[model samples]
Target chain A: MSLLSLRDQLRSGSVTPSGLLDDLAGKIVSRDPEIGAYLSHDLAAAKAEAASVDLSLPLGGIPIAIKDNMNVLGQPCTCGSKFLSENYTSPYDATVIRKLRAAGAIPFGRLNMDEFAMGSATENSALQITRNPHDLDRIPGGSSGGSAAAVASGTAFAALGSDTGGSIRQPASHCGIVGLKPSYGRVSRFGLVAFASSLDQIGPMTQTVEDAALLLGAIAGYDPQDSTSLDRPVPDYLATLNDGVKGLKIGLPKEYFGDGIDPGVRELVMAAANKLAAAGAELVEISLPHTEYAVATYYVIAPAEASSNLSRFDGIRYGHRAANPADLLDLYRRSREEGFGPEVKRRIILGTYVLSSGYHDAYYTKAQKVRTLIRRDFETAFETVDAVLSPVAPSTARKLGESAHDPLREYLSDIFTLAANLAGNCAISVPCGKVGQLPVGVQILGPHFGEAKLLQIAKAVEG
Target chain B: MSKPHIDVRYVANLARLELNEAEVAEFQGQLDAILGYVETISLLDVSGIEPTAYPSPVFDRMRDDEPHESLPLAAVLQNAPDQAQNQIRVPKVVADA
Candidate 1:
């Protein structure tokens, strides 16, 4: 059930939170063995926790699944990596978890993700790869694959997923659901396990735009703990969500529509745009000229930030420790080598290389400058249009193992979604339609802090 | 394979990760390819453009110097690989002469 509908039932006393948990438990037992969306779920703990939550609150009685990266107190925050998978338990609630609890939502289940939310697909997860529910053999796009799958498979009322580059939206697209990446600072990142510190934002991945809005509202706000969170008031996203795009200008970036997009994918995205146009949204031919550099810029910047952020996982404090190390250095080296998966190690190395002396200017600084250009492209486009629309990914979910082994191939798949993260703009992926039973989403990009208008446009195109 | 641009051994050492010989060779090739792809930024003239370190660029965020309750000591030590006397224990850093 959609979280809103479940919320309605709870409000009317038509159903109890315990009853909803049982229904979700039954669904997971039947479906998750094949989906592999959950890393762990504690029904007893969840029910116990939910018993105290006020039923009159906004998200009261809603059991939202959380991506494994966010620290929900006492829950396993594995981040799909061996480092934390073994014995690490969250010492405190992440800011998001606290806010959700305050709003009376029960955060249930640890959804699987790429190791440290680094990979484009869950294949890089050290624990287990979550498969797409649509086709069991194909990958659910990641690093929010588990969240997307759980929500889509009806196992979750809604789920929270973090978007570093295309993590949330791409996975939601592949799983045929609604995924949102709010403007950087629109949502607090204090509790999210850092992937790319500057690029990562925790957002909602749900089955509908209405649910995304509800989840975003409960979670979006400035937290004193997160210095990057904006100080401005978070407007009610639901207030204008149903407002049709009667005369809003939506841009169609020509660069996105160019070669390399699958014909089937292009047709579906265009059809969705037509729906928006029919609803009085002007589809202007916009040019994000620097769009070509988004993936490359993101790869350099994200990895650079990730390498620095992930350096905290040395053997000393709370993560994996190697046995009988010869010295302190050996302990640090061996523990990381043993704990991190290959993709993670590769990124750390790449990040170290770029940030290393003499190479920093040529790579990291250059990527940041290119990032300015990318942001400028959006700034320029938004001046003329209310929002920008494009395909969420180049294609639908690929069969597992198809691009799993090739890092470059996987990185290239994030082309369409990286610019929003780079620009720190708000964006969402609403399922447009499916291509041969596999789903794709039409991405709607909004100016920074423009989520209210963005969700409004998303609702119009949702049809 | 063509000559690699990055010294994988040096970078891995800097990252404090110990990769075996086969893993090193495999990563060397992949990193070189990734580096080559990321080199596309060179085509654009980024001169005179200020680099963006953070997306929103909010600066000087400070909180009052207020004391608050800290995490319980037991919970803090619970996840430690090795802990003794409420402290995280690690190998000795000083080498005996």
Candidate 2:
């Protein structure tokens, strides 16, 4: 059953909260070993809470798995790296975790992700490679692979994921689920381990658009903890979600639907766009001329921020410390080298060089100027269209280890969805149709803080 | 494979990461490709445009500087790899210097 139906069952006394947990637990026991969705689950604490949870709360008794980056007090917040896994107990609840608990949802388990949310595939996880639930040999789209996998496989009703450069949406596309990357400051980032401070946003991965709305409603808000968080009201996302997309002009960016896109995935996305147009929405062609520069800008900006942010893990205060360093410099170097994965090291190096004195203007500063252009492209497109539609990625889930040989190939897959992060706009990935055994997702983008209209259009596609 | 453009050893040193010979060679190749791709941004005419450090308009959001209760020292220290006398213990920098 979907989250709403499950909610109805809980309220109607058709099934008790404990009974629901048992069913979810049974699924976890049966499926999690194969899927590798969870890093750790607190069944004892979850069952204990199920007994006394306040059913009056909006998300009462709903099980929500968390991507490992967000701190949930005592729960492990391993950003899928050996450093955080070996050290760092969350000292406090992230603002979203506090909100989820208040809304009566169980923040049940820690799902695996790319190390510090860096890679597109969960293979970057120091612990395990999360498999796509649909086909075990394929990768669950990542850095939030486990979050998408958990929800896709029914171990959790929904999950929370952080998107920097399509970390949430691409995984959702690969897993064939609903993933929303809320506007850049739509949700608090206090406890989310910083990947790219400017580009990261916490969002939902769910079975349906309505569930995404419910999950977003529970967590989205302004928080003083995250200085970048906008001081804006989060609307009741469900209020207009079911209203449908009648008369809404959905723009299809020509850049996204190009010859480079896999023909099978393009057909599915265009078919879904046709479905929305048939349902009273107008489909229009829009130009985002700066689209080609988005990936380059994101690579520079995200890594620059990451290099600055990750400098905090210096082995003294928190995370893994090197054993018997010859000196402080040696400690910092050895600890970071031992702690981080190869992808992380590569990004840190790239970021450091980009921001270094001689190269800063030529790379980082230049990238930022291009970022303004990319954002302007979205602004121009939104002037003529209510929302923009496109394929979430060029292709469906590739086989495990397919992208391992070449890192650039993996980065290229993010070309379609990376611009939304650059633009700081809200976007969603909804399953449109199937491509063979894998699922293809269609992406819908709205202007900043246009999640209500975004979810509405996503629901029309879901229908 | 094409020749690398930047000194990866210098960048790795700046990043505070120790890279072996093999990792340096691998990263050099990968970084060259990535830098080559991102170099496309330099072709655009952004002469008059301002660089966007933050995507959003809001900046320097300030709260009153007031004293508030902080996390208990024990809780903060829980994750420390090495500790002594309620403080994080690290290698002797002065002695090494």
Whose TM-score is greatest here? 1
Q: Which candidate is the best by DockQ?
A: 1
Candidate 1 Cα misplacement greater than 4 A, ranges: B1-4
Q: Evaluate candidate 1 and give its CAPRI docking class based on DockQ.
A: high
Per-residue lDDT over A1-463 for candidate 1, one digit per residue giving the tens place of the 0 to 100 score: 6777888899998999988888898889998999999999999999998787788999998898999999998889999999999999998899989999989999999999999998877988899979998999999999999999998888888999999998999999999999999999988888788889889999999888988899999999988888899988888888888889988898999999999999999999999999999998888999999998998999899999989999999988888999999999999999999999999999999999899999899899999999999999999998999999999999989988887457998898899999999999999999999989999899999999999999999998885
DockQ of all candidates, in order?
Answer: 0.85, 0.83
How many steric clashes between backbone atoms does each model show? 0, 0
For every model in order, the TM-score on chain A comes to 0.99, 0.98
Worst 10 residues of 2 chain A by lDDT: A1-10
**Per-candidate RMSD, Å:** 1.3, 1.6
| Candidate 2, chain A: TM-score against the reference | 0.98
* Native-referenced Cα lDDT, model 2: 0.91
